[model samples]
Target chain A: MSFNVIGKSVIRVDGLAKVTGKAVYPQDIYMDGMLYGKTLRSTVPHAYFTLDTSKAEKIEGVVRIFTAKDVPGHNAHGVLFKDHEVFCAQKVRRIGDPLAFVVATSEKIAQKAVEAIEVKYEELPAVFDPVEAMKDEIKVHDGTSNIIYHYKLRKGNIEEGFAKSHVVVENVYKTSMVDHAFLQPEAGIAYVEEDGTIVVCAATQYPHFDQLEIAEAMGVPAEKVKVINPAVGGAFGGREDITLQIHLAIAAVATGGPVKAVYSREESFVAHSKRHPEIIKIKTGADKEGKLLALEAEIIADTGAYASWAINVTRKSGIHVTGPYVIPNVKVDAYAVYTNNPFCGAMRGFGATQVPIATEQQMDMLAEKLGISPVEIRLKNAFTKGSETANGQILTESVPLITCIKKVADALEMA
Target chain B: MKKRGKGIACIFYGTGYGNGFPDVSRAYAELQPDGKVAIYTGATEVGQGAKTALSQIPAEVLGLTVDDIIFINEDTSITPDAGTAAATRQTYNTGNAIKMAAEELKKELINIAVKELGLNSDAGLEMKDGKIYLKILPDKCITLAQIAAKQSEPLRTFATFTAQTVQIDPETGQGAPYWPYTFSACAVEVEVDTETGQVEIIKAAHAQDVGRAINPKMIEGQMEGGFAMAMGYVLYEDLGLENGRIWNNKLSTYIIPTAMDMPEIQNIIVEDPESTAPYGAKGIGEPVMIPVGPAILNAIYDAVGVRMTEIPVTPMKLLQAIREKEKQGA
Candidate 1:
């Protein structure tokens, strides 16, 4: 069909509404008899702990409070591994661990009540290094050792591939943990109706996933819980996981009333998930003619206190370590090691953004040794259809990596 | 190559979300008794013009003016699921649904006009702006409002779609994940100060295999936004953490690209239409940022003969690389 408006750059439908301050975010939605909710966070970095909320529950205007014991369903929710606690019960892992949820008549009273909650902890020396955290004796988590998940891309013989190369470049690159830092803080209002249906409206990216997790935490049927995405300031994959949705749900169901939970900017920084800090060791090999042969690398990702899709991050980092190229042989050892650092989850580039810094730079270094431009070396090896990746996966679909590379090469005239 | 250079970089990301989830979508359009065409869509405009896309798709479908179509969006009670407005999927996935709803309205209008006017057994009739016109006669016409009023019927229908997104094998990570892949490339030219190691992007161009330019100006905005973000990733943005807490917690510590940081963006949108898209269109959001980082770093290497292995090629890293060059010279 011919489109008159479809192909036009018309004004955003909500532009005027948002600009006029009429756009209602979750925080803007205020209902009658709504109580303020706040979470008590652990101060220690790592330890086994028990939080008693008796004193805080007795504070004036403090309606009700919930520890992990108050949660009726499973106490954990994570994308890959269900390891994170909805509320810390037996142990405090990270400094931002939520130990108790307090409901009060006002935000000021809730803040005061949160200070009254007492948490007992046996402090343990924490490990923040991705490499050394894997060896830490003080298990931050309950189950396995620090190594959460490992991903590998094993193809042709790596040693033989390097042997066939005229040049081999090795370098280690590191990227710090990055927060999504969406302008909107995590805000949500949760209320349980008379029919036992829990309604949670929040600034979230994934509504369906939030609905499922909120249902579990609320101890209700999945159909009973509804999550509506408010005008999210920005997500950048930050709000993909449930933040205030389940917590508000727990607070509402526990206190038996409507409750609003808003994370301050400082609280958001401490509690929210971040991009996995990656330490990637890249080793690239190219032939005399600048044809790439192999790229073997070891990558360690700090998954932090709990596993929050670090399994997939490790997997992606393992595959893209060789990058969008043709390599007859490639081996990538990618590990998501548990650490005392902030929890790491998804970001814009997934995990591929970190490795390119290493692998692409190695390509430039190899190009130098081969007396060729970095563009020339990449063009010679850019993966087209029929080229097998390091994971033994052949590109039968759109292998536009070379085409994209050429377009950019042409755009810049990097001949 | 001239010292002042231009380079191209192709950045491609399979923009549509992965395949495993339910690819559900629906859109409804109705002509009110007041002669206004209202289109109902569940696509949320998270600053990306999904409402305008909805308004446009139906206008093109039913041959109505864009101004005539009142778009009702992002309300599940009124609008059906057109899917989330992420991944640049609105122009294609939501577009097809809106087209179907409009087509149904067109068909119903033709039927009503054919039955009422006794027009030559309804052959070669075209619907334009809520009016049924005879293709052969070229002048015979009746307003849809009149036909709808005469027929004593409401003109409302819905269209649903399941845009195919084949999921990749979880192990190998290779599959035709996107229904139609949107391709983009960027080339950036940067000049580095030899002494201070300050680098500035001289020129930047983005060429995207957009399947179709749904809106060239919108694509330009995406390109400009991506460049700003990539500029931040290249020369500004960083997450400084100490112990377990982030040191750069505020804007004073963390910096993003400002207005002064923007370079002249040459946005080239290529449209080799995909058969499935509304007018052969694909998602083009994430691609804008994906390639700019490498392009800028590569340019830094060209400007100064140092390969910046890490990101935010800040003055310190550039200066240190320059110092290493000085040591070699000595």
Candidate 2:
């Protein structure tokens, strides 16, 4: 159906406002008597540290210094697993771990106060590899094993299917950790209104979720906390987790005045979650006709120190391990393991971006081993309507792989 | 020495949170006393032209011009919960809700026009270009302004659209994860510098079956932006963590592709309208980026007889692969 506006390329609604500098972002928000907030992060990765804030408290412009002890409500918050401490009490698990928070009259004073606050630490042996962390020896989070979440998918009899195969190929694929790299570093402003409502204006993807999490952390009713998102510079998924929402609210409520916090570029990197680094061990077996017979995979992802969206990412990785191919027999084990590394959570593609690099390469290798062209091999096993995936989901509509392959092939030939 | 080659990859993405996450959108439509229309919904516009597309729905349904509609959006205190503006659902889910609300308000206006103009039947009364006309008479009509001026009652509506999605089984991961899916294909040409180990993307051709293009120009913009980001993911961008700490903490240290690094791009839009979608449109935001990285990787292999399995295929890795291949051949 033709549409007057649906298919037309109309300009963005707020383009003029954005270009004309009329658009107000979280960083643009300012209030009278607002204290600039700063955090003192741990210098050592894993250690028990005692924070010395006596000298910093004597800073001329410093309003107040807060630690984990000053938190009136729960001191912990996370999206999937509430294991991260807002402010470390004694032990620091990662380099970005917050030891203390300072609020001062200016950002310059807050930075100086943060520098004056010294910390002493006794180092502990830390595990950095996800595979080693999976051995259940060095527990990243106390009590719980290093392996935070494990998911598996099984299909038809893999042994029987593999026995019928004529060729088998195995490969180990690795992917490094990456950042969202959104243009906007984390920034927010918080203040308590006259009606006793805590208001947080920030650049975030999800405002309602932020409000609830802040309310829960402040031990206030959900109605008492309001989160208003201004023009987000870019989210990609880094802003999905709490950056400075709860910390800003704590500062505002504690000092009984408005407070603003903006993460420097360096702080933004350590504070927000990163894409999980992965190790995928995959083996594929196919018949003489180049049809996939059996497949097996073991995917280990370093979720780093905390569980943000690790469970969901692991599950998605496991589900998409088979890629777009029609595989009847398959067995997959995907795990999100914890390590004393920078925490990992959501990125643009989450786990979807990692597994495809391996699976697609596996397909190319299989095609070469079978003495068939890449296009021919993929066309042989491309999914169609009524086709069931390794995870048992049936494709009912919009299965256009064959058409896409043909189109691309034609385009390449023409070029 | 430099060699050039081409490769292709395709991807299909599920739209919305289809795993039993109750997806719903609400919209409010009210025809004002001055003959202007107002739309209220909590759909945030994160630089995606949501307000433009949403206003089009009410304008098309009510037979009014887009300029005549005023949008009040993204305020939680005033607008109803239209769900999050993620998963590209604002155009489909929220657009449908606005259409329903506008249709309801149009019906109320037509009924008043019928009563005020002494029309024989409601069937002959039609609203077009902000005027109600009797189809049989053609000239016997009443303007929306006159209708509003004679309003004995309020003209407004509130409507909601809840997407029906199937929950996948937890154990098998089977079942319909989403209501509908969007499809895309990408073909990339690369020139591999064997000596320097640098791969230059000469050109890229991307085709997306958007089910329907809600806004063709917007879709093209999304394609260009997604492809550039994917180019960075495949060749240049890496977080480069050292001992759980960021090594390249600054933009100068962490390199992303500048405009000089961009390749020539061609975008092709395929329209196979989805029956259940608003304006028969499926999302193209996430699907456009999925196939690009793999296509670039495959193109690198095509250029040189080496397969680099990892991401951000760095120059050093490519040089090492070339050396390994040379030693094996020797």
Candidate 3:
């Protein structure tokens, strides 16, 4: 199509507003009658707690103090499952879980009121490893086994392929949990107006997704709950699931006045999601010619107290286990087990990021055994168009992968 | 004492699923009684040249200069929703929507001119700088103001579209869910220190399938910014949490890539315009950084013949790898 602008460089829409400091962030959403809201979180990772909200509510300048009971609709909010509680009523499974909350006329009052609130806790055994948790001695969530989801991939012939191979290698690797760490902490202003409509504004990604989830938690119609996104600092999939959105709506409906809640940098990191830490074990068999015959792999991921996209992450890791290469025989088992480690969900690079790190290392190892260059071994196995991935799906287009490998090899001058 | 070695990484991401969400964007061009065209759209400019690319679409469509048009509408109350300005879909999706709006406005203007003049000439009419002209007749034309005053109806245009994509099967994680995946690959050169295991990036070149460069300068910005972020991911950024509590929450504790940590980057564009996109654009935003970390790790191996195998390839890990290699030699 003949065009003048679709592919042209234009100035940004918010360049002037951001650069000149005119852009109004959520913290800038100040009004004449706005109250500050703060949650009282548990100090211990796992404990049984009973929180009394009366003391904080009776404090001077303090408004209504609420617990899990104050929630008009669903008291708990989570995307995949209804396991995580909005307010800790019985057990504080993780250290960052909110046990109670206080609302006050001033931000200082809110901070003071949170300190006035008292909680009694009995520390319980906390599980941090998925391998031990999967034994089901202790449950992160009640009744169910500690496993959220287990996925398996079986292809070609594993035992026969291994027996025919000249060399076999087995090793275990671990990938660490990382954070998105967007500049904007969890901050939002919500109020039930005179007409009884709840307006919530915050800096967030996936505004529509949060709007619908907040509606369900508040027992309000989706239209009545208008979630507006202010200027976002950054979100690398950190805001995909519901966070403080439902809590703000609840506090607003209970207080009957404008209420704003913002997490400090410490709270944002403690409460927000992180990447899953995976323990990957792999046994590979290859011929003397360096032709890879089979791969036997098992991976376990710590899904934390609730299954927050961790199962999907492990599945993605399993799918790309062989990397961007062709493997005839592949077997992979992935388990997303519940642990008391901090809740991990989505971050940048999603799931494929983890697999490449492990598989690429294995490729380097195979090259060492075969007395070939790392780039040479990858070029031999790199999937081109018409070549099927390990899952047997045809790659209809985009054979540039070999070229991608070649370009890097040429740039590195790897001989 | 610490000495730094250069490192490089390369990678890219799959474009979105074509489940076809409604991408309805509207831009109107109102030719004033005097000689001016004002453009309007709901495309919110969130720092990535949405307004500039959008304004150009209308100007190009109306056969007018870029300075002659004003694109309006970021408020959801006034403007139709153009899906969130993400995945670099604004220029491609909203730009096409604006062009359609301008074409519709031009069509109405020609119809009004024909009605007022009582001329049944379907043969030749084109929009040019505040005037609608008849190609066949030299003097048989009218200015846009003259045509609007003589007509009863207001000249305005609208367009709504959906950008569709398919999802890869959950089982296989294979699908062309994208019209075309925005592909970018990079090769990084790094120098690793044998003693301290500090890595430094020396030179880098990124080759990307930019669909078509909507804004060459903006594309370069995305490339360079992605380069820095990816470098941070591989070398510096980490969320140091201890026992579910963030140990390093503040900027002082958490490290991001600084200007001093940058490598010389050569950005290359491989344009294979998407058939379904506006001006054939696929998203160029997130894919820029997706492939970068791997490419840098790959380069680290090339320099020292060691597999870092993990993220934020710290000096401690590098020192250990060097020690292990020395022990094997012994």
Q: Which of the two candidates, 1 or 3, achieves a greater lDDT against the reference?
A: 1
Q: Worst ten-residue run, lDDT, model 1 chain B? A: B1-10
lDDT of 2 by residue, B1-330 (tens): 999978777665666655567788899998778788899887766665677778877887888767778887744556677876666567778887888899899988888888878876699687888898998897888888888787676577999998766665666566555566666778889999999999999988888877777778888887887787788777887777767778888788877778898788888887777767777777676667778888888889888989887777899989999899999999
Q: How should the candidates be ordered by lDDT, best one leading?
A: 2, 1, 3
Candidate 1, overall lDDT?
0.73
Q: B1-330, model 3: which lDDT tens digit per residue?
A: 333333323343444323233444455667665645666655555444566667766777677766667665433333555655554456666777777777787777778767655678645776677677777774667787787676455566678756555444455334433334455566677777787788888888776666667677778887887778777776877667566565777778888787889888878766666566666666676667756776677667766767766677877887788789779889
lDDT of 3 at A302: 84
Per-residue alpha-carbon lDDT of candidate 3 for residues A1-415, written as tens digits (9 for 90 to 100): 6555455555664567788989877877887688888888888888898876677778899987878887777777765677778787789888788877678898889899899888888988888878999998988888899988776677788998899888777777777777776767788888876777777887655455566677777887766777676766666667666677777888888877788988888888777777787888888878887778888888888877777777656666676566666778888888888888788877655555665556666766777788887667766766666766566565555446656555655665654
What TM-score, over all chains together, does every model reach?
0.86, 0.93, 0.84
Error of 3 at A202 (Å): 0.3
Q: Residues A1-415, candidate 1, lDDT per residue (tens digit)?
A: 5555556776655577789998888889898899999988888788878766788888899988878888888887876677778887777777788888888999999999899888789987887777877775767776678997767556778899999888998887776676766678888898887888787878765565666777776667788876666676776657766666777888887777789988888788877788787888888898899998888899999988878768766766665677667788877778998888888887666675566667766777787788998678878877666665554545554455555566656666677
Q: TM-score: which is higher, 2 or 3?
A: 2
Query: Per-residue lDDT of B104-172 in model 1, one digit per residue for the tens?
Result: 887877787787667867788877766787888867888867765764566788888777755455554
CA-lDDT, candidates in order: 0.73, 0.80, 0.70
- Number of the top TM-score candidate: 2
